[model samples]
Target chain A: MFRHNTLRYAVLVLLASAALFQAFTAEYFGLEILTEILILAMLVLALDIVAGFGGMVSLCHGALMGVGAYAYALLSTTAGIAPPVAMVGAVALTGAIAWAIGAICSRSHGIYFIMATLAFGQMAYSYVFEAPIFGGDDGLGGIARLDLSFVGIDLNDSRSFALFCLVVLGAIYGVSVLILRSGLGRSLTGVMHNEQRMRALGLTVWRVKADVFGLSGMIAGLAGVLAAQHIMYISPGLLSWTVSGEALVVVILGGLGTLVGPLVGAAAFVVLKHELSAVTTYWHLVVGVILIAVVMSRANGIFGWIEARWGDRIERRLSDTTRKPEAKEVLGDA
Target chain B: MLETRNLDKSFGAVHVTRNVSLKLERGERRIILGPNGAGKTTLFNQLVGELTPDSGSVHLAGEDVTALPVAKRARRGLSRSYQKNTLFDGLTVEENLGLATAVHTGNATQLWSDSLAKPEVREIVNEVAEQVNLMPYIHAKVSEISYGVRRQLEVGVALATRPLVLLMDEPTSGVGPEMSKGFHDLLNNLPRDLTMLIIEHDMDLAFDVADTITVLNYGEVVFDGLPEAARGSKLLKDIYLGNWEDA
Candidate 1:
């Protein structure tokens, strides 16, 4: 009775393509929203790794993404590097920053961790907002799209750029799934549960925290580069603590531990913000009310509610088959 | 093959662990018994690197590990269980054991390898689960299991590390008598290659499982001898059993 849902996979593929089809044909406004969703979804996925799974609720991931965007801008424009190389450089730089922050913050638990990350994020905001080399308050502009004319793909075309963003999102999703099912993911889960016990089990707690944070930062940096390419602009606003706060909200409002919730949360967030802002400038008031309602009624977020209703049964069936209960049966028989 | 020399730790004006020196030979089962505030747990903390001693050294298998961190000491074949449950609440029994084994084998950070898909890891996890009689609940979440089963998984987690010296702080503290018996049988059936250093409050369970016994009173060792000698000591009766032993 528990067969793999091939039809479900097909439906998912069809739905994904339908969204892409809409992006390709929709007006400039719709295409821009789709691009923004892809970029922000990547950020939320990055946040999910540390805050959702590792139980380290970071408030500086937005600043980390800013680091990536700024690095890309500076490296490509100033150092005369190619776009791809600049992006990689930005990710590496952000990874280093995240490592330093993680080493300090991972020492603290609960509220202390949150406060430490918030402090670091504010520090990033202050630097970017004041530093003249980064365009200070005015921010940077004229970020060019990747030159893929050699491959006959004109990235300046909106349709091609949208497709590019979609492919990147798909790749990130696949990678995230692999990571969540691996030993590293298990260790992070253990760390989240009990760091002391993980230490006793011969796993260094700080190192694990640092590595995960670095990985999260790298992924966030990837989003940063994409955002830069999409808007052709980078600003201190990108690095503000408010951006980090929003990402944290998205992760929480989506589902804290579910990998797919953040993606859904990103979509809901962008759509809500876009639609609500049109109605009134007090759009934030409505968002606040919705967040409160979600927290009070469904603490697990929208995806969590869905999981409770249907995802759990499907998950249980799949896991039951994947992990044979032979030993359990042997014990029962005994 | 474990030794602690002149381990001293103080908190401001209060001395928690005082100049404590202890030794355990290969394969010896030594239980440290004390009153509630005798600082037995503090002493264990020093041995496992959870709390560093202000002075003195911890030598495990002839290596000086006094300056080593908890995970490094564990990687060098020193492992322990906490006094509290400390099991990963969201993970399953098999997952808890598998995590221990994965870290022990230096595979905790293999991002691409599916741990559950690996047959050898699964086999070892099952084997450890069987040893602790936790096979039945291997697929159940830790939060959904009984406290007794959680206790077994705690030991199972430690054992999965394949430690040469196992340090347990009150392994059967909150478990019922029926469950304690099962814990005792599991401990008794542990391979002779494993040396155990246990901190236990249950005198009967401690005496039954331990080949040697050490008694601590107010941050100091009052007795270190065979189980028979410990049982016959008047000081032990005074501190732990009280005058009611005569009844």
Candidate 2:
């Protein structure tokens, strides 16, 4: 358990240093890719909490993010609200929408859940695509970054913005790690594993599901706000099913339940798509092939594979005593 | 502490549980016995709020709970183990017990706090695991444990919920004879404050543990009395072991 903690911290430190180095040296195109990766990683992290850990396997996450993006876009650009206020509005709107959706879909499981969320994604996509207030197919533009002059931060500079986004991503990851160790997290796992047994044990399964969904939606909304601020643009494409599908792919590619896996997945996905598209217009074909190869090689995703190779070696040695802290780690309590 | 009034449940033309009424006093060990498809498990389900009776009311500790959902009924001091092993197969035994205890203590909805770090919850979970003699396998995943150990864990899970009335559906169904004796020992050692309503196929086992017995045949309660009197019941003999005269 100590080994696992040390290793996790080590990896986090390394990632942070790398992020800092990239922010300092990267050109405009490189910084754009870096910022996009951080934003997408947050999105995938939200999905991982619901689909990977909670076993909801939601397909409407992109729509939830779009809810946030649209909220920010309209409030900041049209209503002339402060960017921070718009961000909060975006997160609030996404949370409410996600809770409503979860209330309707939480009772259904397996394929039915997938279909219901997929339908929701399609609904949001169509609504945004045709809604005149949202600029329809053309989308909203000229969105500015949050006024952080009080904090002495200028987000207009790409490097500063990328660093800020990275910090936000780290904060989200920290909160996620804390949640995965909480009582509610265990209850969510219980619901995912055996909902009936959870109910028998006096857990309100639907409420757990809805609460988890709302939390995930809030994070996704944060990602959306950051994405809008980073790009200064918004479109119906932000709400499209393809974005959800890509996030799912990242979750699967990184590792389902392991919290760090999605970050790796987001990085791999963004870099691969950017580089492959430069080589050929048929970038999706290459992406699909690479995904198939990675998934086939490492069934548990890259992080699970790493754990099996290295983490388990240290873990096996610690299992002899069944000490409290170590045992909790074995259960992935944190 | 539990009473059912004319509970009736049916699917299309087949009535699984019909006019089934029974009572269990606090601290008593009551067993319901029946032949195949005689609604023994179905009765247990209705009592625990797993199945809504077509027309009946359920009372737990003098509170009417027929309209409550399963979790609410559980919150009202009801807990149950399934006929099949419905464990969180991927999680460790400690985690399973922790989750049950967390829910029982109303700590299940805690999102920001680290539950495992809570000394009280951990102490309760460890106590339950120790009670069930599952301390050795606490770190083992449910799927990695032996069948008998899994059975113990199932009971441990129900016990961890701090139930006032526990519904056990065929607790000894899959265990071998030796393990069955261990189960008997475990039940014998349980806290006297806990009430148990059990469904068992083994007559000897049922009679051994039960303070009182109820017999069901074709979804109707044909007999309810002391275990000694139940053994002498001609109706029970005819329905369970076939013909009393032939025996």
Candidate 3:
């Protein structure tokens, strides 16, 4: 059921074309916005793994993202390390943090789990919020990007940097696809269906969920590492529960349980906020209304609706041509 | 292979199980029959470790298992079926049954990142699905199936665990007469070494399958003997039919 389709290809193409536009015609400002969209797409995809697929709707992802960001900042500054090493270290540390939170929170499933993760995430935020050594509320601002001299390219250039983010996004998307198609993905879906049966089968259901939830946090960490370097700034606001809620809202806005839903949601979210804020002070009201409309329609998501109304007919014809031999049984069964 | 002594449970003064005690030998099939509110389900829940007993002991195969949780109880060769069909609705039959096989094998590797496409899991799932007459419905999602079929699927799930003891409550609650007969034959032929404890409202099915009958009335045993002896006991009928005025 999960494979490369027109939607995936189209979204990838759309991302590529936008990157090309920034690389050639647009100024550094346009390139910066494009980079934010691309990286946020990665973070939203990570959020989707636990919330959309595994049925663990967490609101602490932004705080976990902070864990990654801080990991990169501290490792690079304290050890005078390169960015690549810092990114890896950050993701590993964040993965561990996510696993701890997941282990504790997965015990309490449903809405309580969401609230529990939210509380834990807030705890992380407040730790950074109050810790004087980590720059307190101002964040660790003096961190540096990886000095990638071996590649014979200056990452200081916004054009080159955008390319780095693009490549990272492509790699994460590929890995996400692989994970979603594996046996683990099937079991995670099974957990959502019946944890009791999963437990009865002698599965360490909690550990599995906690691990995957940690994996999602690691991916989000990757995005956070990229964002921290690009922005050259970090603050307590980044780890706020509202930011996590917004990410969730973006996921819901794009679509739930769809691979590309969160990406579209994030992009659409940033773009709408950018364009609408230019027109009026109350942009959120308008975005909220659109979000409400999309959810109420139960249209699967933006592309989900597009696929339902338009994509189905196309698929139906494709199946009809390829499965002529099974047509009798297929029609008879229906 | 299983026994409980002086089991007592209370929900704010309503004593669910009061000093309930019973024992069974390996290969013995005991059916617990009673009317509604007889605490049959509650007692089953306690024995299955879903509910804790305030003052009793649960032993399995001569080991004290009173402190074990539900998952451990299941792993210790205790499997149960609900009065209602408890199928994992979002999963396909093969996937659910595959999990059941994994349970009995005691494979606790449930990390979501691991693959379930191994040939071992596939082979075991097919075998159990075949055993429960669910081969034709292997690919079907449980939610899309009928209750009668779901009941069979639940049985397939239980059988996959390879339990030393099987506790089934109302296995034929909503089944058709024809399918009920099929399930009866299937239950009757289960491995003799599997200690069976059942609760059924259907008297004919009970007499046809059970080696011995245990009638429970108001959380107390009224009879425990052979099927012929149980059928001849007026007290058993009176308990089952809820005629408690004389008692």
DockQ (C-alpha based) per candidate is: 0.54, 0.57, 0.31
Error of 1 at B199 (Å): 1.6
Q: TM-score for all predictions?
A: 0.91, 0.93, 0.91
Task: List, residue by residue over B1-247, the lDDT tens digit for candidate 3.
Answer: 9999988888887877878888989999888888887789999988878889989999999988899878788888888888887777766778678667655653334333334466666777888787788877777777666778889888888888888988888888888898899888888878888999999888888999998888877677767789999887878766655667665
User: Tens-digit lDDT track for model 2 on B73-143?
Assistant: 99889999878888989888888898899988878889887666678889999999888888877888887
Clashes of each: 0, 0, 3
Report fnat, model 3: 0.33
In model 2, which regions exceed 4 Å deviation? A1-10, A295-298, A314-334, B232-238, B244-247
Where in model 3 is the C-alpha error above 4 Å? A1-27, A178-184, A310-314, A324-334, B103-115
- Predict model 1's lDDT versus the native: 0.85
Report, for every candidate in turn, its global Cα lDDT versus the true structure.
0.85, 0.86, 0.80
Candidates in order, interface RMSD in Å? 4.3, 5.2, 4.5
Candidate 1 local lDDT, residue A292:
92
Cα-based lDDT at residue A169, candidate 2: 94
Residue-by-residue lDDT tens digits, candidate 1, A44-103? 999998988898999998999899999999888878899888988988999889988998
Candidate 2 positional error at A46, Å = 0.5
In terms of TM-score, which candidate is strongest? 2
Task: Quote the positional error of residue B118 for candidate 3 in Å.
Answer: 1.0
Clashing pairs in 2: none
